[model samples]
Target: MHNLRRIRKHLGITQKALGDGIGCTQGNVYHYERGQTLLPEMAGRLIAYAARDFGLVLTYDHIYGSAQLPPVAMAEVVNRG
Candidate 1:
């Protein structure tokens, strides 16, 4: 579950419009925005769209509610730092 609603609102778009952009139903967008369920593909598409159109980096954690990195990715990031 994620706070997609907040993002959508921030972008001044309706649920139906976001759904249309994401290829989901308005009901699905409503539920997803309410943190009921969010598909990864949808999340990815949303992030890409936001980045491309609005220059926003809406991260999966920001939307999906889990910002925790996997151990391997975290380790790699840490090593680089």
Candidate 2:
């Protein structure tokens, strides 16, 4: 299983909220947690949302978990909570 669900739950955000951040639907998030991987753009957007809104640092590897995702550069934000 991907860390998407875990991270979202940890952040206390709903699928619809996360999907809105990444420009997807809640159903898409539902499918992503099952097996599908997020597009690089969407992943980056998620990372940004996590940082800007939730003050949580996130990365492609963090989001993909054990999935074989290529490395992508993204700025991480230190938790301000």
| Cα RMSD for candidates in order | 10.6, 6.7
lDDT of 2 by residue, 1-81 (tens): 457887776666678878887789999999987879767787788889877776667877787766433322232212221
Q: Residue-wise lDDT of candidate 1 within 1-81, one digit each (tens)?
A: 577887776666678877776778899987776667677888898888666655556787867675532222233223323
TM-score of each: 0.68, 0.72
Query: What C-alpha lDDT do the candidate models reach, one value each?
Result: 0.68, 0.71
Model 2 TM-score relative to the real fold: 0.72
Candidate 1: which pairs clash? none
Model 2, CA-based lDDT: 0.71
lDDT of 2 at 14: 79
* Cα deviation of 15, candidate 1, in Å: 0.6
Pick out the ten consecutive residues of candidate 1 with the lowest summed lDDT.
69-78
lDDT assessment of candidate 1 = 0.68
Candidate 2: residue 38 lDDT (0-100):
66
